[model samples]
Target: MQKHIYILLTILSAGVLMGCEGYLDQKPRKSLVVPETLDDLQALLDNAVIMNSNVPGLGLLASDDVFMEEAGWAGLFAEMEQQTYLWRRDGGFEVIGEWNGAYQKVFYSNVVLERLHEMEEVVSANERGRWMALKGAALFFRGSAFYDLVRIFAQAYQPGVNDSEMGIPLKLTARVTERPGRATLEETYKQIIGDLNQAIEFLPVTASSLNRPNKPVAESLLADLHLQLGNYSMARDLSSSLLQAGTLLDFNELNPEDPFPVPFLNSEVLFQSVMAVYSFTFSSLVQVNPILQASYAANDLRGRIFLNRQNPQVVTFKGSYCGNFDYFAGISLNELYLINSEARIRTGDVAGGMEVLNTLLEKRFEAGTFQPLEASSVATALAFVLMERRKELLFRPSRWYDLRRLNNDSEYATTLVREMGGNTYILAPGDNRYVFPIPQVEVDQGMKQNP
Candidate 1:
């Protein structure tokens, strides 16, 4: 049954991916059908092949959080993976997983949104709620896809500069021939935020499965979007409200000795999605950075629960919420705690921030060994929260996104360094390399490439 589901999903994914251009062109295809019924539209989004959460796989491969030893690099890394590790941009530089995956999902979303209006007349009053929910889900998926795409393909959103800065092509319609040019960063974010806010109003408060977006999920995405936009007060308000009703998986309750300590769909997870596992997180050769591992206090359960140390220096990630080797990139309650904590500190609520951070830390540290963290000033508390955020969320998709946004602030900016093949490569804050070049194929077709 699982194999059949896999085959079906593959076909569905290919159908969308291959048909994107043709669909946009409004060309008739024998293999494709315009979603004429509400179920037909909902079916497109239901196919997790297109909609299940994904992060830029290359971003994970290139992040500073993990490293490969020289021996491991030679023995285990693939050509594309190695190039990314070295931050080489010449050949094999297109980050296609994110580009292709996001647009595929966006294509399906545009189809759904276009068809929903057609379904209004046929949708009975009893089915109106279902139809609305489907429309909201479509908008949520579309907005989320664009959000992920712009983060990878465009420069970080600098408010004053965004109006003139290049962004990904914004596709609002399902027409296949809609040769739209890239929108400015400001316009792109406005479209994303607008879609999400409308999605919030139409989506149900709760979804039966984590596979679908709900009111809380939309809110979480909005809160995170606000954070990246540097709207600290908005981020704090939304995340705090989310935490009030969210559930966290207590580390004390988990068995640290288990190979995969956290169960799939754990309590902390608000939505669950994993990036394509391309030997990055699962391989013995790729391990957590030694310094990052050491940053964890002795009694902190996150290190013990999330890592498997095969030897003195080799530590691979194991605490994925997916239960398999795949890296979980979806939002969770723990991240909300960190987000709210940082927002409070940035907004000058020093004691409130510490309280939130301490509340989360107490659960992560061992019982009776944990000391409540107290900070004398906002800076001290903010620093502690940022460090803990890094320590707690390694291998999750947030690291790259965090680095991009944090690079704007000198206090939080980082210069990523990789030492391999007897060479040292440095990526300084605000470097153009921070924004990946647009895929070569897309650019060859006249899409403007990032400089």
Candidate 2:
């Protein structure tokens, strides 16, 4: 279903042709065309969010730029160490795939926004709601992509010093000739919030189905922004609000054959994209680091997700257990509730937060066993909450953000990342190499690239 949408996006974008820099080069050979109605925009948006999904045989061979040195399918010999993801950081594989995916999505947003006004007659109660939702989704995508660009390409979020911080190109109103400057971190974040609030107000809490964005998705992002800014209280309140109201998939009910080690597809997932597994060759590239492996206690159900694959030294969790069980679906209600739980702790509602965390753990843990956190140290509580976040969200593509947030502080900073041959590597905060560089082509065309 997701892959089908990308095919449509290619057709829509290709029909318009050459308006954007990378429009001509999108993969899978699609024909571009202009969107004439709301349905067209929504379809394009859907594909934008999912993109080239399923087909587990094509696993992500992208390297971690700073951690491991591996032979990538692109025939590049590279090693990644701490704070590195090749496609995201080095603009080769991981970084580039995500980058291309983001910009291509952004381009679709631009085309729709440009053409939306021409179809004023199409507006109605249902259509109006849909329009607002789609716009919000676009902003959400753009804001999210840019937000990452700032964190990964620039510096950490320091509220007052944003102007001085080297942020990503703030693609405010998508215009072909708009020579936009890199907006301050403060301004960029403000825009993200504004778009989200509006999105939440307009988008229905219920999505078209399980796999699309909706009101909770907007709120989930809002909570994420606050958390990154160190606005613990706000993060706590908003996250809690979203979680308590959402429905989550009970892991206990999971089919015995289905191997979703990380239960992210619960009612708690605000929105979901796809849950898929790839070829065995790709599976070898992914294994939980020893740090996480050792962290899981015997009582914790999460330990089951990580498997010892025939040897004590070689361990891969449930998500990575085998090619047959690798399912990949994005956020649902369960995650939001966890976010709320973390927020509760961050806001100093230690009891409230612990209650939520335990509620979740009780289900994941065996029938009756669960650990109750004391959260005595504000520091410990914060760390504990984040650890839970990591455990629950393992392999969901959100860890990079967590790592970026941690990189700004010692308590959360991780010296650990995927490691390979020889255990030596490099990441350049000096050049913002850990974050993403503006695609060199994008930089050439007047957009201010990150430092």
Candidate 3:
């Protein structure tokens, strides 16, 4: 199976690299071996290097969770990385792996979907379940990629205001000849929600591997999407349903002295994915935001488990649910808990929300040191949930999405500031720079660029 995957990947890579006209216009070679069997399609998705990992990392770089000193900023090897860290908009990103990697997942998903459509009529009765699972996995991958892309490249979805806003191009087919233009933000999310809804119905209750999508994984992603869209009732309902069976790993079980306290694919993770590797991420000069580090209580196990303090001002993040140097980009029960807690509070179930928040926190802190968190009002409960969400999901792409969505709410809006070499940079709420510019290569091919 590994040998077969290698051959397929080689063929796919050749085809993708054969064109330079546009990011999405790479036509597969006519002589290439096409995936025809269920095993073949499954193997394609199972290529975890391409399908599971390689999620966008620019969001993590741009997020406020970590920062670099001037020396670290100057030491970054890639100008694009430095530019992204500082939120520059003066030039197109020369290296667009973040954009290309996401679209690569879309391309592979389309390959599976198109092939499945071809074989649907002739699928044997015994193969029906496998067929549905493949289709569901493909849809989930596509929807997941689209969601990541929009979160990075488009403006925040404003209910009535985003109908006319430009969004990432929606590539629904494998044919490279179809150079579809950018979809409206409304159309983009409609496609994502529709794809995920179908995925939930077709996927099995549990995936064969944590790297694959399942019913619960689709539901979780959809719930998160709705939460970002401000559909609190729907988000709360979906997250609540998942939590009925979800479990979190107690921090007490982990040794904070270990380089990575959370094991890879631990019990709490419903899916597994790592962010695209960036030199900036592992740079020695980068440090956790001092204020964020200080927010963790001394008795909170998460403080010791999630961060490595080199000194008073040089603390670094060590807790990646991926359980290694790679930053985790996967969905976990911890995230769903936070999502449910916030959604419940937003929807006026303040007491219920506090209970959910405290339940999760109890497992995060030292076994007996955690006290139940209380709030006098919905406003206070929301503040607590949002702050915990930030702490709990540090270094994950969640912070970028949170920043984008929360900026719309006046009460939670934030102005991010960075200081280096006697210079200060500020990103105000709703700044146009929040929308990343499309890759120039794609722009040269006639795709619209972000402002």
Candidate 4:
């Protein structure tokens, strides 16, 4: 069964590697089935091949939240993993599979959406709603993939260069022959917001499992995207609405001594997806950043859930929601809460934001000892929210995005530094290195590459 899925994915991904010019000019294959049935379209979305897994792990690799010992860094067997850990902008990093994996998911989504309209003639009226929901799911998947790809590959979104900056190519159609160039940052985000808004309109309020996206899932993505774009009002309003359905897990109920502090499919997780496992970097020798560990208050339970002490001085991460190994990169109720709190604080609702942050922190800190945080001013409140956001969402593939967005604001901009083998590497704010190079294959095939 898996072999068949691989073959299907190969067929879907064939054009992703080539320049869009003459892409669909290939001869038709006898084995590939054009999605004609409702089940066939749904199967594309349901296929775990492109949908459930293989979202990039690049964010974690480049993030300051996770680090490695000298031996671990030296022992990295995969060339891509090693370059990624060093924050190298070289194109060799695409060998890690995120470039191909994410684009392939986008390809699958396009196939599902393009075929949905054709199914109307053969499908029954009663099932049209189901088909529409599937269409929405495909949109959600495509938007999500584009979201990941744009953030990783393009320069940070800046209002000043909104129309000129290069964003990932917006591949809306499934035509393998379509020749598409990189869209501007403004246009790319416009498409993402449009797809997500439509997805929210069509998705069911509830999903049967965390594996599928629901209305809340679409809402969460939009909220997160808004926060990244510095649209605090929109982010705050959207995330606040989700609070009705969002639930925060109480850390007190968890056993700290357990091998995995956060169990699989925890109540807080709204969607389920794991990043590609880079054991040579994550589970094997990667150590939690000392500064991040120190940020946790003495009474905070997140320190326990996010990091486990191998010895007093050496700690390793064990908080992956996958139970072990792979890192959980999905949206969750707790993330929505943080986004709402940050948006409120940024938008001058300091007291309201503090109250929201306290609600989540209370569940994370020791029961009776948890005191509510007080912010004397909006600046203080925003700073507190940002700090807590880092602590709350560590190793979840968000800190990289946070760094990118925050770097645009002088008040919050940070300069990242790494010392390796007696040399210092610095990633300064607004540095071109913030934009990862386009993958070698894309460049080799005539795609415009990031500067």
Task: Give candidates' CA RMSD values in order.
Answer: 4.1, 6.0, 3.0, 3.6
Model 2, C-alpha of 211: deviation from truth (Å): 3.0
Q: In lDDT terms, how accurate is model 2?
A: 0.55
Order by TM-score, highest first: 3, 1, 4, 2
TM-scores for the candidates = 0.93, 0.77, 0.95, 0.92
In model 3, the runs with Cα more than 4 Å from the true position are 1-7, 11-21
- Give the lDDT of residue 299 in candidate 4: 92
Q: Candidate 3 on 1-451: residue-level lDDT in tens?
A: 1112112453346234323445586655555566769998998899898888878888778889977788888989888888888888655455467677788888889888888888899999999999999999999999999999998889999879777899889999776777789999999999999999999989999877999999999999999998999999999999999995457889999999998888888889999988888887788777888888889998888899988885666788999998889989988999999999999999999999999999999998877888999997999999999999889998898888899989998998999998877878899999987888777778888888877
Consecutive 10-residue window with the lowest summed lDDT within model 3: 1-10
> Model 2, which residues run further than 4 Å from truth?
1-31, 48-94, 121-126, 254-266, 274-281, 306-311, 320-329, 417-420, 426-431, 446-451
TM-score of 4: 0.92
Cα deviation of 368 in candidate 1 (Å)?
Answer: 1.8
Clashing residue pairs in candidate 1 (N, C-alpha, C atoms within 3 angstroms): 23-176, 24-175, 24-176, 24-177, 25-176, 25-177
| Model 4 segments more than 4 A misplaced | 1-29, 90-96
Residue 421 error, candidate 3, Å: 1.8
Query: Each candidate's lDDT (Cα)?
Result: 0.79, 0.55, 0.86, 0.79
Q: lDDT at 96 for candidate 2?
A: 35
Could you tell me the lDDT of residue 270 within candidate 1? 87
Return the candidate ranking by lDDT, descending: 3, 4, 1, 2
